[model samples]
Target: MGGDQAPQMVVAGLRQAQKLHPNISFLLYGQEKLLSKLIPSDDPLRAITQIRHTDEVVTSETTVSTALRSLKKSSMRLAIQAVADGEAQGVVSAGNTGAYMALSKLTLRAIEGIDRPAIAALLPTVRGLCVVLDLGANVEATTENLVQFAFMGSLFARYVLGIEKPSVGLLNVGVEELKGHDKLKMAQLVLKNNPLIENFYGFIEGDDIAFGKTDVVVTDGFTGNIALKAIEGTAKLLSNFLKQEIQKSFLSKVGALLAKSAFSTVKHRLDPHRYNGAPFLGLKGIAVKSHGGTSAYGFSSAINVAVHLIENKVNERLAKDISLLSQHLVQEMENLSLAIEKPTPIKG
Candidate 1:
């Protein structure tokens, strides 16, 4: 109900998602009358689905705090509430992100040993797919937060992307040791030392993201958000630039026509729809967020994400991994705190 396409696109996408994940059932949460129209009473999937209707919705314009306080009957709130109440295994939404995050955090809270949740999304790279985390979930990530992101991101890469030994990399200005902020420097030590974290590459620069230098890229929300936007903007610019250039000349147009299949493959590979869902990792319950402006196909992809997490028991995996790294997480936070509090001796 909150996405740009709202009930229409939501209904169509759910139908398409049913076709994709035939084994899994669905539960729609929105105005029953509107959603009922989208799924006829005779539809087979409808037989498996149940709608928990609510008149309210979390709009894009609504503030997160306001939505949290006022929106008791909102579709987004009810959907997440289902997950919290054990009625649903997971929840997916293409609604107001801030509201979704706030509501989810408030309702589900973070898993034990996890300070906060990081938004993790799969991205297509030159070599294959890469998973990036903290994409606008937490504006500032502490040392412990980044370390947790690394663990959660690696789990996602292995379970979802099927990378056998997913290499982890700290997103930094340089791959060298002495070049990052204190938080990154501290997080890097833990990542390198943690045995559960396999193939721990020390650090990676921005360009390495597209090359798939590592399977999972970890960073604070501010940098990750900027990088995500940059990747999106670059993809659009290149596609548009190539189309304009091809149209300028008859020979180029003919060449493009001949290579049309190749171009189509590239376009689809880079299409945002292919990788539309972002999971709020580290939460006790599974919650996925889709791009609000996405199309029906994109929404279907988001549903796919939720199904994957639920089937794979992603939260359970993350919890176990977090426990594995608990000692390291504790030690590192204490070390960093001490470093901050300790005073430097006067220079000679």
Candidate 2:
């Protein structure tokens, strides 16, 4: 309901997704009466799109527990339950992110060894796509959680992004080992010692995000969210600046016309619509959160992402990988603890 276009944009995206992938089906969860009014009566989509009506709508201000308690007839809860109940492969929404995340985690539950599910977003870089994890899912995280994020994110890059042995870098204030807070220092120690973590690059600063120095950058939600918003804001500002500069004079307008093709290419390269959705990783099922202001193209891109995740079995793969790594770490720590606890027999 908080989405800028709400049902209209969702319907538009659904139409485009059906055209792109005929095998994909949609279960619209909301006020069936309002959605019916928005969609054309004779549209063939009416057949493909199934509406699951709810008496109440989950709002942004609704608490997680409140939302769950009120799930007697709520659209978001129904949508999440669909995935958990095997009715739907995944769930995508442009509604309140907090509500969606809460409902999803509560219903589907987290995968084994996952402390908290993180939001992983793909950013296009000069080299290729770079995956950023913990993008506003958990504001504060522990060293163990950060290390686990690296493992899950590495899998995502390998399977979803098709990068074999993708490099993992710790997002920090500086690239030096001595830099960053205590949390990062602890995470670095674990990453360096973990044999399963491939291409464990030491550290990467904010500047390296767009430069694509590494395939995966791991950070807590607080820093990752700020960095993401900063990058997006800068992109928008630059785009606006270019447009204003190009429209200043007749000669510039002619020049713009001459450079239209090149500009279009650049726009496509930088446009967030091309990479609109982000996956909530570490969950038992695939759940994508689209931009609140997304258009048809953005939502379409989101659906494509969902399809990729489902096809790749990203959630299941992450769960398996994390489970193995977590168990190994637990055993290693236990052995170390026992060794330290034991006193030297004859030293005295």
Candidate 3:
């Protein structure tokens, strides 16, 4: 109901996801009349799927206030509610991202010791892929929040991406420590000193994201969202330019035909659909957001992301890592207190 191709792509994608995780069933909240037409009675999903009809939906224009105030029965809200009520293990939605995030916060709340949640997503890189966080969640964050994000992102890369000892980096204008804002400077220091994040890389630039210099890159939402969009736009621009240039002449067209498999490899490696889900890290319950405009394959990938996180118990690992971070902070504060209370040398 929320996406551009709602029930059609939703059902199609779920069918693909079903093959991957045959044990997981679904409870879809949408218009029954429409869904009945889209999902065939003999389809495999029909065997494992349960439909809950609701006309409410969040749109591109739906405000967060409107959703919270009036859309209780909305599909997105109900799905998230299922997670809160212990009726579901996780949720995947291609609806209004803003509304989804807001409702998720209202219902699921942030994991204890987590100041705020960050939208963490995977980006393809030269060394496979890396995780980038704070994508359009919390436009501005304090140093403490950034430090928390570092820990959460690290756990995400390790648990979901299956990377051991993930290297974390602060996204800055330069690799130099003194190059960014005061908050970044402090965040870097926090990560560097934290025993939990010993693999911390001080700073990394935009190019580092694609180069895979680090396994996790942390930044505020404002910068992260802009960088994410820029990378996506550049990928599309390059793809379109290649196609147009290849069709310019008969010889080039023949070359394109001959090099079709090579092009396919490039396309598959760079396809954002392959990495479609962005998890709201630091939430007690799992909620994955899929791009509203993506196709069935892309949505299927998003579903897999949710399934992987749930199966891996990422939030459980995140909770333990955060406790370690908190313990470190407490020890540092106590040491400072001891030093402050130490007797003065009497100006000797």
Steric clash pairs (candidate 3): none
Candidates 2 and 3 compared: the better one by lDDT is: 3
Model 2: residues >4 Å from true position, as ranges? Answer: 175-178, 331-348
Better of 1 and 2 by TM-score: 1
* Model 1 segments more than 4 A misplaced: 175-178, 332-348
The CA root-mean-square deviation of candidate 2, after full C-alpha superposition on the true structure, stands at: 4.2
**Tens-digit lDDT string for candidate 2 (82-126):** 999999999998878888898889889999888989898989788
Candidate 3 regions exceeding 4 Å error are: 175-178, 330-348
* Model 2 global lDDT (CA atoms, 0 to 1): 0.84
TM-score of 1: 0.93
Shift in Å, residue 313, candidate 1 = 1.1
Q: Candidate 1 — worst ten consecutive residues by lDDT sum?
A: 339-348
Model 3 clash tally, residue pairs? 0
Worst 10-residue lDDT window for candidate 3 reads 339-348
Name the 10 consecutive residues with the lowest summed lDDT in model 2: 339-348
Candidate 3 per-residue lDDT, tens place, 230-261, comes to: 99999999989999998899999999999999
